[model samples]
Target chain A: MNGSIADPKAVRRTILRNLRSALLELGSATKAELSDRLGVSFPTVSKFLGQMEKAGELLPVQLDDSSGGRRANRYSYNPEVMLGLALFLERTETSYIVFNCAGEVKDQGHAASVLTADITDFDALIAALVNKHPQISAVSVGVPAAVNNGRLIYIPEYEQFHDLDLKAHCEQRFQLPTVIENDMNAAVYGYYMARHQRSELQPSLVYLYFGQNGPGSGIMLDGNIMRGSSFFSGEVSFVPLYDQYNFGEAMRASHPHPRFPDGDLSVDAVARLIAVFAAVLNPHGVILSRHEANEGLLAQLEAASQAYIPREHLPAFILSDWEQDYLYGLQGLSLDLMLSREAGGN
Target chain B: MNGSIADPKAVRRTILRNLRSALLELGSATKAELSDRLGVSFPTVSKFLGQMEKAGELLPVQLDDSSGGRRANRYSYNPEVMLGLALFLERTETSYIVFNCAGEVKDQGHAASVLTADITDFDALIAALVNKHPQISAVSVGVPAAVNNGRLIYIPEYEQFHDLDLKAHCEQRFQLPTVIENDMNAAVYGYYMARHQRSELQPSLVYLYFGQNGPGSGIMLDGNIMRGSSFFSGEVSFVPLYDQYNFGEAMRASHPHPRFPDGDLSVDAVARLIAVFAAVLNPHGVILSRHEANEGLLAQLEAASQAYIPREHLPAFILSDWEQDYLYGLQGLSLDLMLSREAGGN
Candidate 1:
């Protein structure tokens, strides 16, 4: 029985939710184990498990060792029972990944850049992917813009996609749960989740990127993405780090490419930004892409940062693949939607 | 019966916790109202209420009007059942407030500056307060330093208080639960709580203060204090906002007093700091003490900040009483401890 002793439908929802979470955590569990863990009766667990199995949400993976009687069936969540579609719309290309509930990628591809095209192109691309993967249960898209609850509220040059309720549009068209996240937000979440150990531990971190879209950051404080009051938490482009120029203008003046610039001006700006993070946030780590933060630049940054703040206060500088982290983040969001949907018995 | 069908103690704890929160929300409620809200059996609620009433933790407020049935008795949580001692150690003086669970100030006073004096002096002040208020159940101390889990890990001028486990020491000495918080954290929380409407709505804000010691800030995001990884989230004095000087250095160079300076340099620096918050945190409000901000200075800051970031992204600048907010925040913390203790039936 649900602990609250609420309405029956609400009780069932709570029981199924707990059972699903336990199954995910345990990998596989016999009806008795789930019953013991959830404090639900054995018959209650058995009924839900039977219903879920009939709905193709669970599978009998193995048999529990018999003590003195018949062996009990150990059931596991069907990893491929549902699929998720993850996509990122970048400056020049649109990349996507189709993954299962277990986060295993089944297909990956690229399409034309949606920023310069119409919303229909983006819709058609998703439709194609959905048709190919008929089991797709959720969709998550990442865009380099300030997103407010799935609406592209601020997109400087991407006017074609500006003010679009991407989540609502996609959900309506595909009849699936959809999430739209800011690019940097997704990247930071992906980076945070990529490390299995760190995923369990909430680590405050800042992921900085000088992308084709411009300089931006993703902030994760205590394991949560800090989407600021106006959903502009990671828009570091306008941060005035100098007397005459902002971060974006200074970066553009120092270098043409997204790679780390060796110029003193650019170096000072990056070091100052890191120092600001150290003083204000004091995060556990400051993550940067390997393409933008080599050993030599990292060394220079560490030394330069000490001039502004104490060395002990600085966070660890990490190098990661931004592309991989972004896709992983999108996949993670999609998987969450699928799990909640399943728990809701939708 | 307990709904969990497991540990009766745990179930009782949950029900009591829920009941306490509901009563606090509803102000006063009848036994049947609590039983229906908690989804616990009427007998269970009746038993707990009876025990709590006998313990003096609850009071029979009045009787509800009969609706062709028995007049139900409305019970309320006893506001004076426990008291909380809240104190802040400042450069010039130590201010304290004794408040009850209902947030009514029972007493408030100030003592000699604890920074220059010995920790014994601080303890004596608390002892005196506790002696007078025998019902004091929790203690909360706010200090101007980085606090990691109630330990004063960073105290620049006050070396005597450095590395002191204030919470543990106080709890042991007074035989009451204690909490130690950073001064700015308390101030921001107090400011956040002072506005009852905002308390219900989570608004991201930064409370900046330039005091006798130095400049510090408290950050509130979605209604929770942003205590960074190292418990150094609001230590913004070292932020290298300018090439030659950090925020503190620049401010000191521009002004002698901890007030809004008329110099253009200070104005620019303040504007830039606001711009940084705009581009990064984008908080709903940037709070400042009335002593440190005025109409003329605020206008200059608004104009100067436009050079860095767009006007649309700027947060509303708010002026509040720093001292009041700090004390209120400490009281809020102590009240939380008291509430949890009452719910635990301890």
Candidate 2:
């Protein structure tokens, strides 16, 4: 929508894209209902639906209620026609989920740390999974490093993946559409999506993590995830929350891996970090990994941050299942890719 | 595009909106060119252009080149058909710019501080301006506090305007579309637009100003200006960059109003703030008010910030005319409002 229109084919593609998106959201509707919903002509909707039906993309659900006229047949999208793969590469393990367009997870599994091994191990893992699920049409990957449009731009710990275009590789290898995102970005997006469905309110949210790999954050304002100028947003480790030390240095000095707030120093550091997000972003909430969060830590953070800013201005501190959130976010991305690929004349 | 399409009327409105936008950007275009550029049918473009021409919204510009075919007529948008009013209510004075659709400044003036004066003074100022320029179709106002959808949610200095839907009041009184934005938000947006046209690269930028009112910031990440939950973003005064003092407290303690970094204490505080944005956002640039920034001060900041974070990660710090940027941003918002209003079946 931001660029110049290319041609009529592109315009038709957009209509089909909107129709598919409407159907996905509506679940089932009559031809007239879809035409009205899409603001497109009845003939256009009828033609596209017929074409998709022939391609096994649509299912006849039921007959619409008759209102003193002939009943129209209701059509539903075939969720099973497209499958998505979502995976996250972590230092200890690689986890994945295979899901349908409707977000129903069909299978989930884990593999050895592909980051420590090599790119071949990453390839083999995806290859094996794709072989198992032939219907998988799209893939989304989550990584611990900063990602620039599917390329690993900053992976100091994993040299094997550094500078690799993981999305291009996966898409080329499997002939499937793929996307690559930072782990924290995906996690926050997943959390935002889960909560957004219930409230339907745009939220400003932050996801923070002190992981085995490093410290990072994910920022979402008004439901849009922020990837910085070079996709370097959420690299909170570099944050100079204190004059004496950066967030990462402070964390490393005060605590051990995974379990944070080993002492008051780390607590102070984490609290200061929370205050930074509160003051700068004023998000609705700040989410932390459930594994590292508890009632005690949250209360301590709240009390500590109050020293810097008013308590009322502080965002709500929450703990979420980071693993689930990350995978769900990846799944969401993959499903979108599936839809967009199909809508782009697949 | 994100919402359910309502009907054919709404769809027609969207096509018209796109056509208007395309024409404005292209300056002038032939029917064939517009159709190809908008991905709409030739008949649709031709019909709408004819209607707009009849409405005096378009002007016949020139004829297109011919290559073994008939030459076509090129049409241009009538910039004089619509005008916008952009005004910023500052503590010192209220500055205004009456601009046409093409961003040409037709008139500029200043009035007494509306924030310090009563609300009637504000009304009278707008009335005088609108009376002089009867062609004005939209209004955009910039204020010094947090804004939530045009309502002044946080204006502690001006209690009379607090919680007032300034946009609603302006539109109701003037019978024109209106928008209200925060001073810093408008400034950053204006600067972004000015730079975006030249480079066309989406930028992550920050605008910082220590003014007579208070310290605040504007954040634009990847071309989107971030308004946080409750619209409390850019309140950088509360950011706890130091254990001993917040940014506002440190600035007030070391420096007088209108000037900054008068001593080492304020310098350290400002550097720490820049470091915070860098480590967290990794923005491409951080902009400062030209009035406050000097070569000596910037050098001091650049060196001091390196004490907190790496030099390479620090965003490029530059001085900008905050006043011009603020007005330009408001003008842009007003123009968009005008177009959107005309496209909404007006």
Candidate 3:
């Protein structure tokens, strides 16, 4: 681009942006690969690579086999270049973690949450984390409710959180870009990214979080979170059972005794929900997250699915990791924000 | 581009392709708009417009108002440039229609189909249509089955259609590009395009077809069909009912009568599913197609949805057009193949 010489500063910025994107996409790239991929001269790439390396934005890794000629160096994005703070809010407690650009945990904290929960102590915790790691560039949060463009529209468990705009609060307090997502959406996104690393796992998946109160699902089609018009697409708790009794009916005091025992596991309602997923979305994998999906429950679910779906067409069922999935999702959101800031420059 | 002194043929091809694309995207464009959109010189755009008009691929239209001063000519895609042959195969009979690029009907045909009915007479019908309209560029077929990469993988109601590789057969016999889509899939796609044009309908939608033997659904998330792995998504007949009996169980002769009359409607099951859709996917609208979705049925569905979903959160319920929605879907598919060929060129 500089060869045309229209504007030196603009071309330099473009070159740097392209270089960063190339390295991040490929995980690591040789100087020749960077030049070929970016349509830039090798010398310009080398000059920028050297500059970025000195600025602590890029790192050089020597190849394992170079044929003993001039040593070939592969460049990688510096994992520690920036930190992302993630907060997951539950009814009783709020948990937080700091992760680097590569999603590796650097620090962690927690504070109790209640109906009276406010940003006072939360602000203190964020301030402490930022004081320890001044490089934090973004914050991501997950809440148990319906969120639409950063505002909490509904939180049955915590009425105080309703209509709250946590994104603005975090941005103002931490002086960083912020994002708030539905807890179910975050967990499923995390699960998909983790499972997708395996070549055999299909890219499309649905994560059903069978909870104590009801069920909620998160959908990933073609590796993108399927955020609906209101950004509240995955609120599955409201799904009715085959009868007038919806999943939420289980929580009602006057609800009749369950036809199937064992809670969310091995329940007829859960199996019917799974059947709906199998027939409707036909995701490659349907993960039952946040529940003790034991082998017995798996057998019953398999049997129920067989009765409805063709045996040959049943999606693979797996129990998801209960604890780390949300954190993984938060990290994924953090990385997205950090990288998108460069592409969008805001 | 031609000013760069590049090969004139490649430049001409590029110019024609860009002009056609701009007109299609904008519905209509003047020479100035073409120059601005394509980043081509006005003279170059005007020259290509003249050439394309001569070739009958472009048509010039006068604006509604000219005011009698240097009237500008608006160019539109020649709707009659090529024809798209669409065949909708059903249980008792097969119907065919030929549409132009603008999805206007040009010709139509039909043939009877039975258990032993093969494509022998259907092939003759197709050949006759092609013989009459040699400009036909492609063929699209809709079948009631689970399709995977142009192969019919399952059709429990019609076993003969199973594993049928209709795309290759049509491609070889007609010498035209061919596409085979699920019938329900096409209907919802057509429904979306129809409603999408009105500006009042929500873009994301789910179309439920409660047929006599089975029920199936089609989903449109973010304006794209949600074709799951194996192209088998939206086979809603396989969804498990809340009771021991699933939807497919109705096919089993030994199975007892349905617990609720009217088949999944005016029943808790219908309400439950509506609530599920209301909360889970949060689509803008839900259209009940090909069913006796009368006022009573609508009342039941609305009440069911309202029980779990907040009144404000429910999607609009529409009694979809049964007869022409599928044809509209076929037209949409035909137009897509026609436009995509110009864009993808393969």
Candidate 4:
């Protein structure tokens, strides 16, 4: 290790990195506590904190009383220093969200349902985001399609987005590196990160997100998104659920006699479908978002599913708090990118 | 670096490790090739090769012909230097396999009609394996149950093996480090590793192993097993296919006014059930196998499945050629362990 390579600039960067991580994990910490954690002398920690404060990276916050001593000033990372831009696109609408370093939604904007095939609206969406959030450092867009090597390879259901150079376009427009991922993958990551933060659960997770037409599944193995070969591994909608019997005929047959003509396969039908699918995948849990999920219908479907499977042993199912799901995913992607960059630097 | 601390013992281990990986990937190499690949001097490669040959770890193979000069003698790692013991346990039978360093099966043995719930039989299975292959170095067992952190946490349909201390029992009997994994996990790993070796197509794999009563699914995401929280993911069989519709009712509804009056659901009915299930999961491919997946039955099942799914764009469906999918999984586990160990050492 060359002494010159460990220059003041490099040392300062390392100190900042350590402080950022500590703040991210602990929310806030005192200079003394950070010094002990970083194994740096108290004076060194104080000096770095001073420099970071001057650089507008850290903000001083009032601290609680220390044991029998005067209260020391605590420091927290400035949320506005860097922002993450997240774009979530579906069949009906395009949503853009800005999240701060602490995974909090700083701002959000949405555009009316735009057909993905007519990507003319995509440019407008990006333009709106850049204009709204000038401090955005990186952007991650979620598409209802398959992405391979950072390229949108296929969106069979949403054919318009297929073969689109969303990554290059976004990067050039925003002047920031961009990543485009499968919406299901993003949702899964978002759900997993949220669950992990809230509970003492396992590191690995499988999430099933139900949409209008079909359900999408995302798997996290060993604490990382397991993007299978060609990045189409988690396309669970294509997973076969029923044998060759006509779905239409089965639905009709399930309808009661003519006197009690069965109502349309309401939200309940979809929930039953989800429950069945969940039974098959046996994931950690299934997450239903109100944005797309028919909660009342799923409850009825779940009851039907129990009757069909006759097995009490099944993974838990929950409805995602929609207001937070997409935003949470966006924040998680930002953190993932930051962590990867930091790890690479190390 | 202290010269004495990095003596022949350390040097020899490193050289052997590098040589093992090179051989695993490239099969064989000349001393000069090994020297260049290992980034060691030619003299060091020669010395290490000589020592390895003396220790029976390296074997001199046919020479590689040069353009005009003397041919170069190529050395290969001895596959017998390390052995992997693989156990595949089913409801009624247990298959034991010993694999060489290169993942080729050396020998196989079997025990019949042993119930996993019966402790004596389980112990006898382990005893039989130890008695048969005393030279086995490491053991990997595949149980038809869900495993969480090496513990059989849930077996779903398997009433007997739920929450059993399988790893502990195996370790106690064998007095060797052992890995106990769910049968589906092993199947997925086996399929992934086998395809990687045999084909250039990097398809996302979803392996469905049809047992006597039902089927078990193993999902591979990005060439890795999608183990969920509690290692209970991929239990696709339990996914509900019909709501309040029994197998007989589902069949009768699909084929109204059937020629036969018998209430028994035909194998075709089961095939239909499978097809419907497959439609929901939409895997890149579906592999049907069992402890007894013979060629004749496999062909019939494949044909029937094709007829069941109406979608022309369905994923490829095939039958596993290997009789012992669990053995292949064991081989994969051993290979993974070896690769991880080498990675850690480096």
Candidate 2 shows a clash count of 0
Calculate DockQ per candidate and list them. 0.47, 0.40, 0.38, 0.22
- Alpha-carbon RMSD to native, per candidate: 4.8, 4.8, 5.8, 7.1
State the C-alpha lDDT per candidate. 0.81, 0.81, 0.71, 0.62
Candidate 3: residue A293 Cα off by (Å) = 3.5
Q: Each model's number of backbone clashes?
A: 0, 0, 4, 31
lDDT per residue as tens, model 3, B1-346 = 1122223455556666556656766788888887876677789788778866777687657773475787788878887788899988888788899988777898886678632476677688788888999888888888887677677777776666678887888888878888888887788888888656422434778888767656778888877788887666777556554555554453333343355554533345555565666666777888886355777778777886686778777778888785588888887777666654543233
Model 4, span B238-303: residue lDDT tens:
544433344435434444423334543335544544554455444566666654455676556567
TM-score of chain A of 1: 0.84
**At residue B204, what lDDT does model 1 achieve?**
90
Indicate which candidate wins on DockQ: 1
* lDDT score for residue A263 of model 2: 48
Scanning candidate 2 chain B in windows of ten residues, the lowest lDDT window is: B255-264
Off by over 4 Å in 1: A1-55, A58-60, A63-76, A197-199, A255-263, A343-346, B1-54, B58-60, B63-76, B114-117, B197-199, B255-264, B343-346
Worst 10 residues of 4 chain B by lDDT: B337-346
Residue pairs of candidate 2 with colliding backbone atoms: none
Residue pair clashes in candidate 3: A239-B276, A242-B269, A243-B268, A244-B268
Residue-level lDDT tens digits of model 1 in A98-168: 98877888999998898888898998998899889888889999988888888999888877777989889
Interface RMSD over true interface Cα atoms for each candidate: 6.1, 5.4, 7.8, 9.5
Q: Model 3, B171: alpha-carbon shift in Å?
A: 3.5
